[model samples]
Target: MSPGPRLPRRTLLKASAALALPWLLGRCGLPENEEGLRLDPDGILDLPEGFRYRILERRGDRMSDGFRVPGQPDGMGCFAGPPGSNTLVLMRNHELEPGQDSLSPYTQDQGRPAQAYRPADNSPGGVSRVVVDATSFERVSSNLVLVGSSRNCAGGASPWGWLTCEESVTEGHGYVFLCDPLADSLQDAVRIPALGKMNHEAAVVDPTSFIAYLTEDRSDGCFYRFVPESPGERLGLESRGRLQALRIEAEPRRDMNAGVEPGATFRADWVDLPRPGAEDDSLRAQGAARGAALFRRGEGLFFHEGSVYFCATTGGPESGGQIWRYTPEGLQGGMLQLLAQSRDRGVLDMPDNLCVAPWGDVVMAEDGADPRWPDEHLRILTPSGQVKNLARNAMGGGELAGVCLSPDGRALFVNMQGDGMTLVITGPFQQYTGTGL
Candidate 1:
């Protein structure tokens, strides 16, 4: 059968009438409680009034492929299945590392396949595909799609498939792997080494330029972009690319983590990294020496409209977090803007994975470390500079990750990483009037 029609990428700047009006008010005040988050009686997740959640999949559950659901779920993406059908496909990441409990679909007793990235290593850090019925919110099936990797922390979605990245630099690891979510069986894993080998966090692609932007989870990480040798070509077995790091045109080696105010705009350029996948793991250091700007703990990234939005999980003067916007200016380079910074833990504490809501606002998942962080929330940043609570975690401070909305915007899907649970939230989401930035 032919593949389903692909879902159109959501625009980053498109806002609904409801959100556009309130945004015009400009942070004057928050909306009433009737439209605010409501407490959850289950003591797990608290959402706004009229909103409810259902656990779609839990770790340890036996999947259709006979393998148990892996733990430590991280980044994910939603895709449309068979054309004009309610079928939806979700590619989820399992953030497992070496020496951890074995959750891999393959067991040593079962004998590893020669195609595995590291057959000798048992820790199963990879991606899984979950098929669901969007109309009824029923799970059709779940199965392991990619395996035999390490610490598959977070990744992004492309026009063609899911891009899963490793968070380790272990010789054969620390590379990005692409997985087709609609496939019936696991395909041979292929690593895109040209994307650089570091503590990979997340990535997003600009469909127009076929340029992929990636983030590294290191404290001194440098933002990077991969320019494929053949622009707009499907990145596969025959593809080769050039990796480059970001640099501020005026302040080449500026420390973006310090002394930068909101709304500060910087002209940016790319510095070519002659050796991205070097075994020495000196990608960041080499790029820095070549005038690339540095970021503190680069984390989640998403592409919307013509710009790329990303977060620095442990940035800001207070060591809270920061969100930045980069808009490409064609061949003239691009512009980077600091959209928001966490000045206090109450506002946004260690923001992690993020996504653009259907209404155009940015929704962030908090990875706060405080003991009281369980009360941390999924924060929404309005275009008018107002930050408001969208949902709160009542489940013992499990860092929220992989926040994405269904293609039709009827349901919002997110993961509670610590508990290895995926949730589907539905309700009066459209009533939200916060103007998106």
Candidate 2:
């Protein structure tokens, strides 16, 4: 099938305006240089004055490949479209576990794909690809690109494709899988076991070193990286590599959950692990026993400007959240800094997925730990250690996931996980984000 035609810029604007009207007044009490988030009348996402959003895709929506869009959309990575095409491709994860057939990518008649991993168990977790026009921001096409993984959570964009992580340690389930953003059909579920196999949350390949940094979703999880004997071997990450965990050079087994203050830096180094694909879930334990530093719960991971930034949900003094930065000195040594930590749940809670915006600041999606207050938000952490509100889940309650941006930096894409909605937010992004982070 052919891709959708791109809509004219004026036409797209007119259509968007008809869907969402301007908020005459109100402010989020933001910084003087930033605009306040206007309450969304649609009660979905509240954005700043000039920003508007388009619901690009949702659960149960039929795709170009005949399969239905799965629910629980989690992590996402944006890629430049094929060759000279004026579009961006989104490789998005659906975090469905077994027995979620109702929210699976397939219908009763459709069933699981022949290439699905763990077909008997019918694990309904995978990644989908969506093409959007760069100018209009309308979806050109959508399809399932990877299937049969469990709890496909947050992942990072790599030069070759998307590094989707499965946040599950069930039998034969937890591993990172690569998905091509440009593939129009379901691809084979090839697991990169060398990346490790225990509650994998996210993975990001360093463009400079081609070494992949990974995050685990355990309370005692260890930050890991897989160094391929040969960099840029493409998808051959599982082929002859050393899987290692991060260790504090000065302090061994430093527990980050004790709450490290923002801006505190430490010398960091990597310690090689015994077996990344061990039958039991002992990878973190092995690393911990070997003097590797421990994080609360590693979630989203992003590499920007020579530094790797990752979120630790349920971390910090109050177990609110923590964001850490690992700046690689070489491939083996680096400096680890506590970039930000939430002391109050009301301000910034359980930062899950994050990406460095084109103009600099880090955009974060909160998976709030407070069950009493279900409101989650999308926040921006500036380079100077200031955290500001950017958007909120006006849709009642749902953790914002898959926070990413178009290559041209014109649109920001994120997923309302519980609501299973993918939104494209467009506005004067650069005007508010050039501060650098």
Candidate 3:
């Protein structure tokens, strides 16, 4: 009959500060790999000492709805079920294109809907929902939620529901769609063109401010934010708002691809764009003309404590990756800091989707492609700036995506993009010590 305890803002802020201290000290303790990675007998994944994983959903498994599981799972969010229930509702995105007919529900004979967002095209990209019993790690049901989109790459979870974004800029595509994980049918999916049309990757919203920050996954990308006219109202609908791009103060059109020193803070402002839904894919170009700072492939985005953290997958001089933190100053300004950059492939390679762990660590999924290290990894970046491998891909070199934690922090869920598998890892998560900040 009572609600769960909530983390106070002050406590979260303190925890964030503690996590940043290690970076400020300029001395991150090396990752603890004493036991090394335990080879997985299943030949799927390699984990550290006390961790193990289960294959919750595979590419072609039959779902509770009689439809086969879609392939190329990307961004995902976990929502706690009704009060006191151990169930969790997960909305997962599929980075499928038009030709992946065999793996999509739309292309399947029996599960095809009467209509889709794009009724004529029959694009195989959309979102799927899965209900799981957290305590047992058993899947309750899986069904199609959104349909007829292209490359549903990465999306963000909102206090209200799920915001799935398309990573395509085709004339009729490249929009954000809001899906209710609780919805029983596809009729509820609504396209939110107000979020702007571009190569969208993922998004995160500030609960307190009601402001949504998005990432664009292009070689030349611009960091963006959507300020809804009314906070907490249905975004893109009743909460119509202005879409803007971030610009570094006194550094017009600065190319962040060269990388910046860690802890280097830059005053930043948002530049308003007149037409966010332009079909020409010139949104970033228009923002660039107005001095918007450009990033090299912006990917994962998350709002934590009082700051927004995101990754530029191929941003550094080495073309490895970069993570940046943006702390809002007030209504019109903010302070941007280069949190970390990958100078070597061994340390961090092409960081992709990331999430703030329940225990205050930043869990990053590496999408790196280096022949030297044939496999990819699930890396943990402690507040103290130390990076450690938590899990490695034994299933070839498929890039990991959709790294999120269960509501209770007991289960960590992730996806192997290339293999079309969703994995749930459970372990002595709280006992592991991160590099002290």
Which pairs, if any, clash in model 1?
A: 383-435
Give me the candidate number with maximum TM-score: 3
Per-residue accuracy of model 1 over 1-437 as CA lDDT, tens digit each: 12111212221111111212233221223322213566577777878667789998998787887767888998989888767767898899999976666555553455555556676776578888888898977788998888789999889988778999899988688888889878756668977877877889998788889999999898999999988988888876557888889999999888999898665778999998878758777989988999998999999898877878899988887778988888888854788887777665645679999987666677889898855433556777765545556787777667898888888788888889888888888876656643432
Clashes of 3: 1
Q: Between the candidate structures 2 and 3, which one is better when assessed by lDDT?
A: 2
Winner on lDDT between 1 and 3 is 3
- Greater-lDDT candidate between 1 and 2: 2
- Comparing 1 with 2 on TM-score, the higher-scoring candidate is 2
Candidate 2 lDDT over residue span 138-239, tens digit each: 999999988888999988977788989988888988888888877989988767878878998999998889999999999999999989888888764446
Regarding TM-score, does 1 or 3 come out ahead?
A: 3
lDDT agreement with native, every candidate: 0.77, 0.81, 0.80
Give the worst 10-residue stretch by lDDT in candidate 3: 7-16
Ranking by lDDT: 2, 3, 1
TM-score of each: 0.89, 0.90, 0.91
Name the weakest run of 10 consecutive residues (lDDT summed) in model 2. 11-20
